[model samples]
Target: MQNSTCHLQPSLATSVALPVIYSLLFPAGSFGNILAAWIFLKQAPTKRTQYIYLGNLVAANLCVCSTMPFLAVYFARGYQWTYVSTECKITNHLGTLNMHVSMYVTIIILCSTAINQYATLKKTSDTQYSQAINENFYRCVLKKFRQPKFAKQLSTIIWLTVLCITVIAIIYNAKEEIEKDSKCYSIGAEANETTAGIAAFVGTACFFLSFTTVLLSYYCLTKHLSKIQKTTCIGEKHLIYSTVKRNILVIQMILTVCFLPYHIFRPIFYVLLTDRYCLRLNYLVEIKNFLTCLAAAKSSLDPIIILMLDKTFKKSLYGLFTKSTPENHQCKADIFTEETSKM
Candidate 1:
């Protein structure tokens, strides 16, 4: 009998590793996000801006997770296009939409949080200002949509924007053969170098700008609170400031550590890797693949970060999964509520 052992291409080796990791990750991410959305939905019945932002994020995560099965299959088949033509078309569109939507949604989330932080500091120098500001913002934006005046016009505009962008990206990807079987196919080389440069610049600007805004907001809030004469908010302000800062920092840390390497520096390495694609740069390709995978893995870890940051999520988890029956449920809720308040 022939020997079973054989060396594998870097791409094949990466493919071999994908399904095993993604199979575990996809379900966990899906379930956690579903659970978080359910809890958040139950708490606030109003359609507020924060709710809209978070709802979109949850929906984005769901869309991405839904694509994982097809992606898993792709890796399982060693990147072969095995689906029917129609199925291929659907998968291609869905996958591209999910990837782009997920990235932009994350950027928007970071930007929204930073803006909220700045607004909170500016309005009343109080964290509770978020509730009113967010509610008012949503009411203002959505009230027009509900009116009989131009509802259909606005709806059509929204849909048209989404449709145009989706179609353009699909066409761009198709023309570029971006999904071709290659060691670097997953990073999504743009249809043109100028387009890629623009995307990289925009994405990098949003990433750093959001991060710096959050950091500066935290510093200003701390400084303002220190100089304030009011003693009523001494304890409450400290608690809220500390908790929100920690939460933002956690997200910033993940984005900085996970994405910075792959998205920012990969172009420099990409040029070098191209010089010796056949033999010498194989190791570089392996590192690139691993970093890209790490970037994807951050999406899975986001829900866990939320849970760590929000005591409400932990309470819901304990209620749903633990032995907190009717007898102890009230106690559990109280405990978690107190923890959240302290946070």
Candidate 2:
């Protein structure tokens, strides 16, 4: 499998369409990831370690987006490899690195977000970060009996940990056998399929657990919010809390739907078709690549959702676009809210 070579001749229509799609999506995802990272950094949480998780999520998304140009160029050239073997290795390494980090970060974020949401349900006006911090603080005291090394600087520590892990993974993966003829290359060997399968299986299991936790948390939060809304007057707190809850729920829904189609079908399709077609599965290959690209859209679409829906994010983004005149800067500025709201 390492030395095998095959040519791809996609339909002209597809050739044209795929490049256009890739070109547009590449920048969109890149910008979105940057915006997300900025939002997390600019409006960092004061208490909960969960902000660390959120920062990791944004950073992972950025890492994923960084591969867009390489992928776009490969796809645009009809999946031809024009780069050197080292470049190919690096590209594959970066892709795998981003993927692993992103998956783990997603799991962590979901778990932390669930705790945050549950806290909101328990304390109506105290905020989620406060609740998470209080719970983690006591948990630390009970378990380690001392403050964790990263407690105060959890966000920075998480970021550094992700960076270290990602770099190591890339180096290890890149050292694997490289097929010179392939223009667009990736790490790992089909001979090691079992190991790859196990890694993917573990990652998938973690994803499902995280997804389930997030869904359940949102369900409980929504139910509680509905009851509160009906019984209590809709005041400033009600408005903001409701908005935050809604925004996060919508993001969760989008992630669920976007990720489901590929997860449900990719493995089954590969198993049924790969034996017969072997590497001659041009259509299937294209479909797989397209799905991968589509998945990349999440990074792009997420920031848009934040800016459009989240009041605080919108305010920060508006600040970026606007020049600060003293009069205008202080113009009540309450177009929405003032903070980098997290998910």
21-45: candidate 1 lDDT, tens digit per residue: 7677789878877877787666422
Cα lDDT listed for each candidate: 0.54, 0.55
- Write down the TM-score of every candidate: 0.67, 0.70
**What lDDT does model 1 reach?**
0.54
Scanning candidate 1 in windows of ten residues, the lowest lDDT window is: 1-10
Candidate 2 regions off by >4 Å? 1-19, 32-56, 76-84, 96-100, 103-118, 125-168, 171-192, 226-237, 323-343
Candidate 2 achieves a global lDDT of 0.55
| Highest-scoring model, TM-score | 2
Cα lDDT tens digits, model 2, 26-91, are 687777768767866765343334345445656656766676665554455524553345555554
